[model samples]
Target: MLLGYFSLFASGFIAATLLPASSEVLLLALAQQGYKPLWLWLAATCGNTLGSCVNWYLGKELLRFQHKRWFPISQAQLAKAEIQFNRYGSWSLLLAWLPIVGDPLTLVAGTLRVRFGLFLLLVTLGKGARYALLLFLARQLW
Candidate 1:
């Protein structure tokens, strides 16, 4: 039982990162298997949020290498990204649950030096709501 929850947590964490993975499937499966929805939700949310934090940290670290010729992002591109991110600002974190764009948003949040408290709060709310909705749908359909 605990292992199932741990797997869900791990899936959620990995899914939130740049790595290609999906926690939604595991979450729905666990929910359908009669696991406690609340714990599942909490585990997934916390794990996913923490994974985003990892991206955030990486983004902060990435700036250090900007001066290197090996850096992938050009100064012009980084400047453009910074402008765009600033235009959307912290509110963008609410979409951190979204696929593709979500991971980058967290990374940009760190690059732009968004307050950590705000980042965590918005990320947790977005991810928790997503898991909650999945659990609700699972209960309703099965």
Candidate 2:
């Protein structure tokens, strides 16, 4: 049981990182194997949320690299991001469960200096809802 939870946590963490991975399958596998749903959900949610926090920290470090000539990001991109951040508002962090954009959203939240408390709240809600829904759907079919 401990091993199962650890696997989910590690997979969830990696999934939230730049690495190309998804914890969904492992989560479902555990569910089907009769693992406790609540523990599984919490493990995945916390791990994934922590992983996004890592992105947020990296975003905080942007000031150190933005000035370097080799920096991949340009000033125009930064400006555009600032504009979008204003347009979307921090509430957009609620969509942190989304696949293609979720990771970047977390990073942008930190880069734009969105309140950490709000970031954690929204990320946890989004991730928790996703896992809850996944488990619900699985139980429905089983």
Which digits, one per residue and each the tens of the lDDT, describe model 1 over residues 27-106?
99888888999999988998999999999999988899999999999989889989988888899899999999999889
TM-score of each: 0.97, 0.96
- Mind giving the per-residue lDDT tens digits that candidate 2 earns over 6-83? 999999998887677899999999999999999999999999999988877877787588889999889999888879
Q: Which residue pairs in candidate 1 collide?
A: none
TM-score of 2: 0.96
Candidate 1 TM-score to native: 0.97
Most accurate candidate by TM-score: 1
Cα lDDT computed for each candidate against the true fold: 0.92, 0.88
What ranges in model 2 sit over 4 Å off?
none
